[model samples]
Target chain A: MTGNFFYFLTFLTLFAAIGVVVSKNPVYSVLFMILTFFALTGHYILLNAQFLAAVNFIVYMGAIMVLFLFVIMFLNMREDTEQHKPVLSKIAAAIAGGILFVVMIAALKDVNTQMTTTAVFDSQIGMVENLGKVLFRDYLLPFELASVLFLAAMAGAVMLGKREPGEQNRF
Target chain B: MSSASNAYFTNVFIMNDIPEVIRTIPLNYYLYFSTALFCIGIIGVLTRRNAIIIFMCIELMLNSVNLLLTAFSSYRSDPNGQIFVFFIMAVAAAEVAVGLAIIVMIYRNVRSTDINILNKLKW
Candidate 1:
């Protein structure tokens, strides 16, 4: 039953990911990327990481994808505005990626059969209460630093997006 | 291909004393799936000309990593992996904000989003 769900979600996720790549229109790509995020959220839920699932839904599908769509729309990109790379290069890229996948699979195929021995599974481990407790305890420093990173990013974005002095036209 | 993955799947899934949820799907399956997704992202990055699409593909790659981390977290019953995922998400958001701003700035200057045109730095 769960295996079926995994297969279905994996199919949805990979299909949407490919759609994001192959779609000529950036708008379509953004939409497809949203679909991919949705499937990933489903995967998170299936893994019982409900907190991360919610975060993935809110942040990736909600915030980040919307930003991508806004930029694409703001720029007013059309399907034909961007041209594809030459066939030779596209094929080369595909070949390279395929080789990478093959290499990774071959290397990690064994990867310690001892991992199957398994640890004690705590269903509550993924709950927000536990995750937050851990976040504030063991990972407190990184949590605080993440806020600092957000602040810097916000400031930098504003400065970068701001029009320069005496500029003729604005974005 | 099916036979190989099936063999690997049985190898990983059969011997585990993991809880029902974690045992339902093999850990090796997650590894293979995420690896495929990551490779797809790489292909998108290498093939696409639009800077924004390339940026999106980069996000895809980041997401694949996040998925793998979450799977490991669950299989090991560890919250620390999920905590790392939170940090990754935070950093990813910041990255997108700053990266999109940079792309916008570049677009403003060049009047185009094609990465090929911004090759003035190439020597």
Candidate 2:
């Protein structure tokens, strides 16, 4: 049953991810991306990383995707104004991605080692209690730095979004 | 042999105590799945001209990495991988915030989100 659930979520994730790329309309793309994120959240839960699942739900699906939708709607890019990349380049891009995938598979296929279950598996390792202990202990410095990064990012976004006073006439 | 050992472990331990997903699905499957997802993101990035779509593809690639990290973290019973995944999410958020702001500013200048139009340094 769990395997079935994993397969289903995997299918949903891959399908929606492809849809996000294949859809021409920006709105449809954003919607498909949201779907993909949801499937990913489900996968996280299946993996027992419940906290990450919630964070992925809140951050990606809640915040980032909405921002994408807002930007798309704000731009009024409903029409297919994008000139498709040349057919040759499109094919070349597909081939390049395919080659990369094939190479990675070839290189990694022989390195298949199963996870050893002997090392006292802590089922609660993914829970917030254990994760928070690790985060606040070893990762404290980076955690604080991440906050500083967010502050800088927020400032930069505001600064960039701010219009120059006399530049309105140029547009 | 590994399956027989796993069965012994399950019999000795409570059924629910075992990591069912990890036991059932090989780690290689997660690796392969994430790799495919990453490649799809690459294809999208290479093929798409719209800046926002490309940005979305980049997010897709980040997600694939996050999935792989989570799988490894779970399978190994290590919390560090998930913590790294958390930080990656934070960084990605910041990146999107700044990147979209820049894209919006470019659109204001060029009045289009198409990447081809913005090629020239000085408009």
- lDDT measured at residue A102 in model 2 versus the true structure, 0 to 100: 100
Best by lDDT: 2
Model 1 B-chain TM: 0.83
Fraction of native contacts, model 1: 0.70
| Per-prediction TM-score to the true structure, in the order listed | 0.92, 0.93
Q: Chain B TM-score for each model?
A: 0.83, 0.85
- Chain A of candidate 1 compared with the true chain A, TM-score: 0.95
Query: How accurate locally is residue B111 in candidate 1, as Cα lDDT from 0 to 100?
Result: 89
Model 2 chain A lDDT-worst window of ten? A112-121
Best by TM-score: 2
Please write out the lDDT profile of model 2 over residues B1-123, one tens digit for every residue. 247225433323434565678767777788889998999999999999999999999999999999999998887778999999999999999999999999999999888888888778856
| Residues A27-119, model 2: lDDT tens digits | 999999999999999999989999999899999999999999999888888646888999999999999999999999998798745554544
Q: Find the 10 residues in a row with the least total lDDT in model 1 chain B.
A: B1-10
